[model samples]
Target: MTTTPALLPPDIRVFERGWLSSNNVLCLGEQATVIDTGHVKHASETAHRVGAALRGQPLADIAHTHLHSDHCGGTAALQAAHPDARVWVPEPSLPHVQAWDEDRLTFGDTAQRCARFNAQHALVPGQSVRLGARDWQIHAAPGHDALAVLLFEPEHGLLISGDALWEHGVGVIFPQIDGSDDFDTFNDTLALIERLDPRVVIPGHGTPFGRADGGIEAAMARSRARIEQFKAQPAQHALYAAKVLIKYQMLDVEAMPHAEFQRWLDGTRTLHQLHQLHRPDLDWPAWLALVLAPLFGKGVLRRDETLVLDGA
Candidate 1:
């Protein structure tokens, strides 16, 4: 958790994490709470980071913005670190979470990893949750993931927007994979953010921004263009999703030998799905090389004969 202290409330700090994990928001007050603990691989680091940031203040609560692997991967570690702290997750997925149903929870089918964790409470939309000594209105944001929520504080004009609205654009419209056609909902969620008119935005992935209105506008433009492109060619979106998932895995490992990397990349069911959806004619290696060309071309990754390194 890299400390980002300026342009935010003294009580609220954004722990900027690498791309593989979501940024954690640490809220300090009479009852201290940390929102969104990054990817599972970094669970121990995240727990230690929270401990160092707490400065002996007992953590009283842990909450999630969503249940994506990157968003809630450190839940178990944090719970272990502060056993007395209550855990709250998005309400829609609580049943699946309680049962640890990997498919419904999106770990199995996606080949993503999330350490099992328990949720004692629910973060229901339309409710005001008290965290970091401020009342946050929990608004249902159903674009990135159906159960995702956005938190806003009217008094401070601060918004804790999850993946639904990033500074650059929204995340993949994952519901489309199930043929749910959630692009409209994603657009609606963007409209909701625009309406919030937040002065500052602490997004799920990047650093907090002060002039969020302009960010919102820029994000909306990108969202609309991407959605139109995705709508026109759904298979392209699937290929993009495959790349993102692959990149996320690469981030988790940092670097991997070619043989192990190929095995891991081939292991993802989502990537296989994309292969079947878009390029059944090409073999896995050929298909992967084609899809990964963009990443390599952009210098975000480096591929050699023996190993692959995440350059970005």
Candidate 2:
């Protein structure tokens, strides 16, 4: 049976289903280039899809906006499939890629998050790449990650924003972990992007959007609001951590036991320490109290003398 070919958009084709693992795009031309590959779990499939999209044309280059696992995980697989293809990455990420530093890549405690990929080329600001005969400009987009870069096609007024600008806010500003949340820097980057006047924006997550609609503005506003909320209650940091883990695991809350869930919370470094320090205000002995409150209200967990997964 023949598999359906990856979706294409005139000269620019987008594989839009991978939001959590940002969508992939293939630009068909004299020099075929693919913008960002999905997660490692989907790497093989992505390579196959890209190969099919090539349609006998050689894949000259593979470029990544950043080194995030979701953004570059499939690089190795793609290269293995097309041995002639050269991997292109941001200049800052070059050293890490060369040294093969898995730790520096921030693939969580598990290396499973990202696969090893070699960078044969570097994309610096002002550098131009010819995709299907038109030149696309590369710009440094730092804030989410200091090494991140964004691609802009001035002729077509198209921007492959990557994680710098998502449909519903930007990617997590990871620099905050080191106490360097320069909101000003992020704002500057956004302003710089606005000046480009991109007619169409292909974000790292969500659908491709037009600048006319209030989508970009709404996302920026939500990002600012979240930053303010993050500053207000530090406990929200722990909550944010929980939310990320939950989304990653996609756990069926109803199948979780209260005690087991509490144990999971206790195992987390931030959550455990936060519970201990704020014992007076939060009451640690009743640790399961706050933990279950939200889930219980959401009908994800039920409490009947003892906590149990709601549906289970």
Model number with the top TM-score: 1
Off by over 4 Å in 1: 1-6, 255-260, 280-286, 296-299, 302-309
Clashing pairs in 2: none
Question: What would the per-residue lDDT of candidate 1 be over residues 1-312, giving only the tens digit for each residue?
Answer: 465556677889888886788999988998898999999998998999899989988899899988889999998999998999988888988899999999888788677889999988899899988887888899998877888899998888888988887777558777776656557888788788889888788889987776634765676688788888877887888788888888887787789998888778777777787787668899988998889999989987898888899877
Question: Once model 2 is optimally superposed onto the true structure by TM-score, how far is the C-alpha of residue 112 displaced, in angstroms?
Answer: 5.1
Cα deviation at 270, candidate 1, in Å, is 1.7
Model 1 alpha-carbon miss at residue 169, Å? 3.2
Q: List ranges where model 2 is wrong by over 4 Å.
A: 1-9, 108-112, 231-238, 249-312
> Residue pairs in steric clash, candidate 1?
none
Measured over all alpha carbons after superposition, the RMSD of each candidate to the real structure, in angstroms, is: 2.4, 5.3
Candidate 1 at residue 141, lDDT? 89
